[model samples]
Target: MAGTSQARDGRMALSFILEKNGAPLTGTSGSLAIGEMGFIISKASSTSAFGDIPVGCFFIASASTTLKDGDSIQKVKPYFLGFATSKSLSQSKNVVDVTMDYDAATNNVSDGVVSSSGSISGSAITETLNMESGINILQSRFTSIISIDGSTIEYKEAQTTEKDILMLGWNFRDCKVGEFLDIDIVPALFSNLSKDASYGSSQTFNVDYTGNFSDENNFVGGHYIVKNVEGLLPSIARPQAAS
Candidate 1:
């Protein structure tokens, strides 16, 4: 029961916790409940698991649509996983309103504006009364929550200092191979997305996002829990590997 051989069957559990703006979420009685979070775990590519893990580090692999406790290497050594999918982010500014009480004779093109009676390039600009001079900028950002039905269900307004909430966690059992559990915390924004439709085929929606590691206290970016099945003294998750 010494050396690497003892770790051959070290099948411990793994859990990933989520925090928003530096505060952990509620209802987490140790780990986030299933269905409350969305995740995809798949086999780790040989290239994805090398060298020193970094802060804000994440891996991308084919999405895993199943969650079963099976006794096989395929079930144990999954590498890339995340919480959210079909995500979208957008920004817009408000339009300004003004009084349309301008005198037709006095209002001219010299004011960077064309009057209702004026024509630019020999074309009458209809609906001139509703034209706007400029936009009323907004300091808050709007986020739309889209449903699977492709409907813009609701929206959330967040300040520059605020962010949307996402929580992802897992509890591994009989977790062998990597021998330890790790979590990657990425503060991301979905940049691009697409949807494909084909005959007799499943519709696939893809989402892309980019973000960096959090520099928060206590969390140290992401967290990892080391296994101690043999009841080692003072056993605890070690400090994250050097950045």
Candidate 2:
């Protein structure tokens, strides 16, 4: 018997075979979301020749950004990724081939977007908030790469302010200093709007995080919430540390 492996990251690729009688279930739809702006789904097909997955039944997708677990936003296609006709797959063929990157904010000096993310592969997507300007933000990077299982979407905790979402990203894991960990956005959000407005105005979330890398001090971690953050946009910036 051969063991199967499946893993993907923002700057990498993840290939897997999702078999369902070599076809989608009747009267059902299949789709996927990468991060805040990458999404695709299986094409609608109800044809089977006893051994062939039709190309019209599948398609390849292009995620404008990337994704991770606990992400609040996900980008998706109205339908397919690529086309395929391996209906007679040898047990299970690679039905889905995907790539992802973390999406970032546009035209902001102190803000940048995270393309995609994953806990797998010794890497993590990150963003830095410039508190100097006093921030008001909505959905910036809402993905969390919990473990190797990949990224998941994070939602507003019970009664959490939208401004506090940035703080929420660090809610889980809380790895100590010197311990390396990766966090990303949810990677899936319905299939249309990335996120809706709150109470008719652009909401805000403040994401302030600290990790004692030299030693284990105290990690204030667990479902950080983005409350009514002001002046911050929905993007994280990767900045060079000051010398």
**RMSD vs true structure, all candidates:** 24.2, 24.4
Go through the candidates in order and give the clash count of each: 4, 90
Task: Write the residue-wise lDDT of candidate 1 on 1-243 in tens digits.
Answer: 223244432222222223322222222121222112212222233222212433133221222222223100111112111111222222223434443578444432333321111000111111111221000001121232222324434332433343212212222333333344333333433344444668886554344433323322212223334342332111112213110
Error of 2 at 44 (Å): 60
lDDT tens string, model 2, 8-55?
Answer: 223221211111122222222323222222212222333321113222
| Pairs that collide, model 1 | 11-174, 11-175, 13-172, 14-172
Locate the minimum summed-lDDT window of 10 residues in model 1.
115-124
Give the true-structure RMSD of model 1.
24.2
Candidate 2: what lDDT? 0.21
In model 1, the Cα lDDT at residue 239 comes to: 15
Relative to the true structure, how large is the alpha-carbon lDDT of every model? Answer: 0.26, 0.21
